[model samples]
Target: MKKIGIFLCLIFLWSNINASAITYPKITSQGAVLMDINNGKILFQKNGHGRYAPASTTKVMTALLALEKCKLDDNVIVGKNPPLEDGSKIFLTKGEVLTVDQLLYALLLHSANDAALALAEHISGSKEEFAHLMNERANQLGCKDTNFLNPNGLYESKHYTSAYDLAQIASNAMKSSKFREIVSTLSFDIAPTNNHPEIRHLHNENKLLYSQKYKYPNADGIKTGYTIKAKHTYIGSATRNGKTLVVVLLSGVKGYYKDA
Candidate 1:
């Protein structure tokens, strides 16, 4: 009986130690998910299927459709409406010509609202039509809780996505070699164009890729977003030891990167 009691105590202690070892940090974001990119396994989540405004993370869908429908070298002539877009921009003016490749770099690296509008207009003839395409693609990807009202992720009452849905969209976008290359780039230059004479140097806004304070090991391609309504949102990807993970956070108050 004494030996049996000692064995039972040892077993209980071992179980306690293992339970303590497997704990996960408290995630503060309202919506969050960590997924294995390769297998679509959801490793962790907090309200992963809860809907929230996605902000500029909508560009992942925009960029993916652009790559699918247009050639990189195809030229897109800026329209009157793109320059009129609200929020961040490269200030593309009417009749300014840039290839699909250049616009993608602007769209992803800089999160340029104007660039997203231009690509949408170029690919689908108008933002409304392009939004239709965005929804269609999201549906096909098995995302049941996403709706995109604009390619640029500007605030709209109905435009929203869950953390899981956004992760699915981002994982699909990362499959493209060009998409991967463009998002991973730290900075790029759009040479002097008909609309502007001086070279426009654009830097990536994703702090995880460049900012020392927020940088994560093995971090690479992905996107970030914010709006008064959305607050803060991010989709971050990193790879280590042959496995890649995609982390999504939406509607966080601040410091979402640290939570990631």
Candidate 2:
């Protein structure tokens, strides 16, 4: 009876630990963080303060900066680069004029490196100048561990941030109506323009929008990231009973190990 009781106690403890860790993975990425949106308390953290390449997730700040510094009605000429990007893209032609709003949509949804560069250029006249703003703004916002070496987050030696820092920045970005609008949109309705359009369709890559298999009902707008090293990083959010939570997973690979 003693042995059986001990085994039962062990099982109960193990189950509790698993439950806590499920919502709190210790180091899924180089760093990971989960936060409560209501009061901004950190729910869980794993290497959340360690620096790692943020990859395309860098654009959340890029878009945030653009929305603050540039006017949507402003016409921006795509500077022969965004459409020529080698990675994920929506393909904007060189010299094509798009409103700052349109270019922003391109940057946010497509994660187009060129669109980021173009938006940077449009906002600060050059990517280098815009990068300066990114770092400064991050500091201003109290992201002590964050740095921005490029507007597009293309993995530079000097560019790095932790999942905690990412969450902080995301928490701020979430306050913006424009940012929320863009990320929540599963598909954007882009009208045709002279460059080419019969209503170009853009889809949000976030798979969670498709009725989460894990029973999260209020899941909504967020971002995903990966690189050769980063391996399927994701930032997710959802609302439950009027409470919101932000979950960050980094350095994650499927079928290898769960965050818990």
Candidate 3:
């Protein structure tokens, strides 16, 4: 009897140890991934490869391409189409002149659709052509399930990316020093443009960077997105003790910031 009791206790302890080793956060998001930036290891994931609308988070790729293709100080003349795009914007008007730097600030920090369109047009002469570039870049990055129909990430039937794919794109973007600096910024001021006289103050939308309630200790940034269909999508990064981590959450019905 004594030997049997000791064996049962040992089995219970081993089970508990195994359970603890496998424990992970309970998240409401339909798709999520936590990746170690240094090694590209997936620490945890739920439906990481499931395709879903990316919403504004698509700007991460847009920002990445802009950094690769243009200089920060390069002048961009806003065209008629960028201003005409609906949804969040810096209210860019046709013929407005702004630097690529200024447009990037608006794109990442303010989630401005117009800014994304402007950058796209500047880079590829049209958003449609820019999307081809986006897909090509995604393929280069080893994104197996991503299709970008627009630079602004506005809803489209085929515009979708998986959590794992987004993490891969974000990881590549984070490698650039300029991209790192831009996404990590908490706020920025875009001086009066040729078309708009008022100074535009852009605030970072990633709560993990600023909100007291939601802020993560070393949170830097990436992007956020939402539409009626896409729900809440976010790509967040943080560095702690010299190790950087990236998290992607998609189709989150509850608060994604808190989940991150």
Q: Over the stretch 92-159, how does candidate 2's per-residue lDDT look in tens digits?
A: 78877778887777777767788788888888877789989998989987888887888777767778
Backbone clashes in candidate 1 total: 0
Instruction: Please estimate how well model 1 matches the true structure, expressed as its whole-model Cα lDDT.
Output: 0.86
lDDT against the true structure, each candidate? 0.86, 0.70, 0.87
What is the RMSD, in Å, between candidate 3 and the native fold over all Cα? 8.1
lDDT string for model 3 (202-259, tens) is 9999877777767665678889899999999999887756667788999988566657
Q: Of 1 and 2, which scores higher on TM-score?
A: 1
Local error of candidate 1 at 104, Å? Answer: 0.6
* Candidate 2, residue 129: how far the Cα is off, in Å: 0.9
Q: Score every model by TM-score.
A: 0.91, 0.83, 0.91
Candidate 3: misplaced stretches above 4 Å? Answer: 1-22
User: Which pairs clash inside model 1?
Assistant: none
